[model samples]
Target: MNEQQENKPLISLQNVTKTYGEKTVVDDLSLDISEGEFVTILGESGCGKSTLLKIINGLITPESGSVSVNGQKIATPAPAESKLVKLRRDIGYAVQGSVLFPHLDVAQNIGFVLTLDKKSKPEIAEAVERARKIAGVEKELLTRLPGQLSGGQAQRVGIARSIAARPKLLLMDEPFGAVDEITRRSLQDELSRIVKQEALTCLFVTHDTAEALKLGSKVLILKTGKIEQYDTPEKITQQPATPYVNTLVNR
Candidate 1:
């Protein structure tokens, strides 16, 4: 880690709250993610796990609260900050569906960000090569449609596109949830390796106990719009914070 990264939080949430007309969704939730730290938010359905990632991505804004990236408080993204535009140019987000455009091919999808930055053609080609090597994207698959991809292949493309800009933090919403068991396992292992190699801070969301345990150095368990437990995955798995947490893990 560099000196700047050591001193700065890649992502910080303070007193974040989101609500509809009558119901609060996420309430006063605060968290910090340091560079290279993988933090997982684990929760049951409707527990606001996905909401937190959206807030970080700036897709959904909080009615009241603040999010700072690289020491700068960010407002909602603008058109100038297109999908290719990194919200902070430091956080990369991957969603659950990972819906790739049916019309675009793998290289085209991965090259999307480079084009937005208006990088030269040579630079885009070089970056694409690196992305493919790092993400293990096959050459032949580059021209194939999303319709032709296996679940794992599609997920790999989604992740590769997210990392093409080389963001310091990755915000993922159950990136592995849709794949089959074997593919999911493979991706998780591959992602762990990539996280270490890239030294990337990641805030990933998942409801699966084992998934959280496998990916996170620390896990935050959310229940009904509140954090019920925040600790290492082993700590949560071995030492439940409450009866509710115990039931969730044990069951």
Candidate 2:
């Protein structure tokens, strides 16, 4: 581990396992993510990529093992409500598709969390402005409702909402998958710039190998609920750990 990595982990999972009925979704998973690292989880469909993200963010509980984020121990089966609420407030999650509230306009959607917390109007406005800049949301779009916008635009708004709270960590699961190739590239560029500028610790999940390679400081490959490789993108590209990973990179 480098000096930065040695600075204590921001997210740690030890022997974590999640099962739905008879199928194990995550099998004895253990990982450590350093502060400010952009880690991408890359795997095939149903490989538990999304499930891992959910566990980190307290959306789902593992059947066994432990998860700790920002020094707070997360309880599996059922996380403590107060602690989970506070943790959720400090983490931003952006999933695929437009998750904007159908009734609210872009600005309202972006500032929804702050509004729920009853923040001052000025504070909410300031946060919305910063989020808009980061997400490339235009001023004109702020007044437009979700149904009025294109897929890319709606996704931009969704991202804006997720980051408006200025959370310590961001978890994204295929957030750009629904857009066209050109729009997806544009969103990726925008997101890359924004996350770097903000110095955010992020865990991004994607099935697209190129996207994973392009965005990750470190890439984690999973197969059958087990880790295949966890290394820098360059290393993963140059020296894949398994036949599946080699073929994945080659293609």
Please write out the lDDT profile of model 2 over residues 92-172, one tens digit for every residue: 443333578999998999999889779999999999999999888999999998999998899889888988888778889
Best by TM-score: 2
lDDT of 2: 0.87
lDDT of 1 by residue, 150-213 (tens): 9999988888887787777777888887889999998998888888898888888999988888
For this target, which candidate reaches the highest lDDT against the unseen true structure?
2
TM-score of each: 0.89, 0.94
lDDT for each candidate structure: 0.80, 0.87
- Scored by lDDT, model 1 comes in at 0.80
lDDT of 1 at 177: 79
